[model samples]
Target: MTSDREQGTGGDLVATLIRTAGRRADPPADAYRAVLAAAEDTWQRKVGRRRHWRVGVGIAAAFVLLTAGAALLRVVVLPMMAPAEIARVDRVGGGVATRPAGAGAWVPLVAARRPLHAGTRLRTGPDGRVDLRLEGGVSLRLAVMTEVELHAPDLIRLQRGAVYADTGSAGPGGIVVVTPAGIARDLGTQFELRYAGDVLRLRVREGRVSLQRDAGELVAAAGEQLTIDTAGGVTRGNIARDDPDWAWAETIAPVPDFNDQSVAVLLEWVARETGRPVHYADAAAEQRAASVILHGRVGPLAPLEALGVLLSTTDLTYEILPDGTIEVRYQ
Candidate 1:
């Protein structure tokens, strides 16, 4: 029942749609595969980039953590490992300084009676000196412009300058001093070890000292001085117990308790310290010394000065001979 012109237009439109559909016959299977492959490649590229970024971030975080841990170890853990106390500072004079075992800024160490530990480094400035008492009644004395490290109760590293050690009358052989040149082993001795200008000097005030070196072992007896140069050259010299070279040690000698002590006791102490022999004019003089008792403190006077002051208090006089002999006589 449609009009003839409308029917004709509809038929032409249908024919044109059929021709267009035939020309576009469903996309080829190869083209569909290509599109899918392109999409997968694009996804992988984006994911790989993200994965790489994540890995970079992880590495950076790990680096930061390691750096912080190292800092913490140095700042906290290392300092907490306290050194063991093996000695005490009996006397510290002048510009004396102290530092920790391996690394630290030098700081003033002025207070006496301060505890000194192993691994402590001590250095003295001009006019500086120190006196220390180690285990076993050993006396350790440092000289001016000296640097040393307390390795143990019986071991010391003399880097520069001089150190004097007195192992007492019994002289238990447990002390040794080390230097760049050699090791000085204490054979129950009172000795001074000095290192300067690549030279190692050992002067035995009493007993003996031995050096263990790569070349051979050399022994130094009492009243002997051993000099070992950088070239391993050895030289021997004689030293007097009362030599002026030992005057420095005398100045820094620890003061003894003088209160209520006998004159005889005082004389013995003085003779022992001065490296001199003590004699009496007679038996009566000896009896008098033992009988008299001294009272009050002598302060920090040197051994000789205290002897003079203490003798003045009693009816006793003393004389020191050129041969390092002390003669006590009744006044």
Candidate 2:
């Protein structure tokens, strides 16, 4: 059933396709040449007796396979090696700026525009503060005029700024902050680490923190502060959980995802964030707190302010002591 006209048109199309592939495609010169040479050799040996048009088809098929494979790697493999999402800005106060991994000018942080990756440098303006959420429920807050580098998921370098961290009680996650003076690591706790000039301050609001330096390692428990100087001299002091020094951090504490949560959950969060121990006036109060549930957003208010607003809805009364202990009462 084959006709001369059909064979002539098909031959012309195959010849044009082979010539276009060679002229337009820009593949690896050596690889392209090698593949073409092998394909042509095979065509000559096996299809030598066949019509010349079939030879053009075989060569074009070889080029398609090569380019298709290269396209596959470009679409699939390259993306796998790109930087991953490591952190995100949860709260922004005033002016916050960040620089990417490469050397460049620090640009104003676009709130939630994109996820933050490691090696990114961020700093706050004189009146700026920010809260960043890392993987595993770790909260990092940067104070005004602080510069830090997100070195890794669990590590940050406090170049010359103050950073507060709160590792949630529900997880085993913690963060290590490195400074010129020493390295401070949290012990399942909420704490602050600040490096200013020749001094590095490590304050533990709840749980404990440890400092590792060239000389040795020292631990500071709750309500304790350790000042490490450039000369490596460590001085110990006391800082209350609800001290005025922590007011800035309190203002920027990561707001809980408090949707339809129990009153006890909010109470416990306030107590923990303010570094106050929680105590119920009686068994009835504890049970009442657990019974009541909350709805809607808490806004961006500080922990104490949010607690006050939420507690006013319920008949429960609460008291905060001088030592930062919060007592809840049903009456």
Candidate 3:
């Protein structure tokens, strides 16, 4: 009987232990709540991280668009703004304008574009002193009162002036002075041209200049001078000598006639004198001239003096050169 009682006690103890083990294997209610809370916190943190990353990317994209738009606006809108003040010079007596800080006085042989930029000014004196300061350190001094139109980045029109151009460090086509006779292209050097009566004088100081005309072209070198007449004559000389004709005819050729035939004939004649071919790019330029006759051999006083004498004889406009090659054209 005693043995049976012991077995029953053992069985009951084993059953109680099994039930306690099963309850321990399963989590408590409070433990389940704690695990759920941790899961929720972890999910919230992941969502917040994703949202922050998305916001950062959005901001970066927005910044890029803003920058690009600003750049585009600058390029599209800036050119339409009003022009800034480039230069302002006081007009001196006799239509001369002086730069506040420059080497010489400047005069416009022709009506010039106003509000010139820095380094360009007009200077003149009634006693045969006129000049234009082209950009690139070029100063063109005239022996006669003259006028010129200044067009920047490479164009100048000589209305009426005897000019000595000294260019500084400018490239080819950097500056051009257009006269009634033709066009002078500068190549970072010094040169001079005078239109007096039917004569034009050209002198080269440091570099070469291309004097282009419908009838001829002349490439002047440093230290060389030439002259020409409206009657198709030419003369070449040195610059050191006193230019007597320039003094007398400084005020002579006040106007340039673009329609004169004598100028073209003179240019062709000058080409003959220079031993170089004068080719006309425009075929009509050769045929569109009226008859204007000139007399005298091509020499120092040949055509310049003759032009002054025959100024009223024919309706011819003259372009003179220092090498004694003159071109007369119809005005």
Candidate 4:
């Protein structure tokens, strides 16, 4: 048998060993819980960072798109809404006045080179004459006691009186002249249209014109004249291109720009303005005309007067024949 003291001591040692073994066999549950919690926190933080980055990128992209769209609207949409320019009041002579679209007050147009827009009504006094430089290389001359309305760049309304039009060589667009009795469409021509007390007259100097009436449509070619009465009866006749009746139009003709232009070109312009054909005396005169350059201003003279001034500088002389031919000869 063993003593009591030894037995107690052995029992104590056995108990200590058992406790140490239990501690080693199982880890603390709190430590495992803390590690799992830390992992979840780290994952949540990473996801939040990614989401914030995406939201920031999206906002920036939206802002950029909105800015670009606004810029595009400004550049593309505004111009189309602006009104088109038709013709300008190139020259105002005598007593010229205008009544704005709907207004009754007649504003005296003392200024030259004023711009005329659609719906503007123009009236000239008995002594008044106005010249208009239309768009597309077209020109118009309004005679005395005339009333006209600019409907658009390519359309005009002649209430009363006469107007002359010249569409240059480029053939930009057909100009429509609306009269009380009929409508005249220019076919790349120089022509005169007159409207008075139930009578309409059309004289084509060059090219052709188409006249439309309620009764029928009539085509008038160069050197042709047509008269339409209030009864819609048509009377056609032949008229000389350089008829003396066209002299009033020449009085307000625009002076040709002669800077570094050839004599031949100037002579051709004179011929057109005077409603005459240019005739060179011989081959040498024609060659000389083609070769010689003209310089200087013609001042504010009529076409014939300006022609006289221009030819004085060269060794050439010209005469207007009885049949309206401008014969150019060597001095």
lDDT of 3 by residue, 129-196 (tens): 44334444444444436654443435555556666554544555556666655567776665667765
Question: Candidate 1 or 2, higher lDDT?
Answer: 1
Candidate 2 lDDT over 252-280, as tens digits, reads 88888877999899988888788677999
lDDT of candidate 3 at residue 242, scale 0 to 100: 26
Which candidate, 2 or 3, would have the higher lDDT against the true structure? 2
Sorted on TM-score, best first, the list reads 4, 1, 2, 3
How far in Å is the alpha carbon of 24 misplaced in model 2? Answer: 54
Candidate 1 lDDT (Cα, 0 to 1):
0.80
Clash count in backbone of candidate 4: 0
- Candidate 4 on 38-110: residue-level lDDT in tens? 3433465458655765676678977655655654454346435544557887777899899766577889988
**Whole-model lDDT values for every prediction:** 0.80, 0.80, 0.50, 0.80
Which structure is stronger by lDDT: 1 or 3? Answer: 1
* Native-to-model Cα distance after best TM-score fit, residue 71 in candidate 4, in Å: 20
- List, residue by residue over 23-105, the lDDT tens digit for candidate 1: 76678643453344334434654586557656766789776566557656754676587766768888778899999676669
Q: Runs in model 2 with CA error above 4 Å?
A: 1-80, 110-114, 170-173
**Candidate 1 runs further than 4 Å off:** 1-81
Candidate 4: residue pairs that collide: none
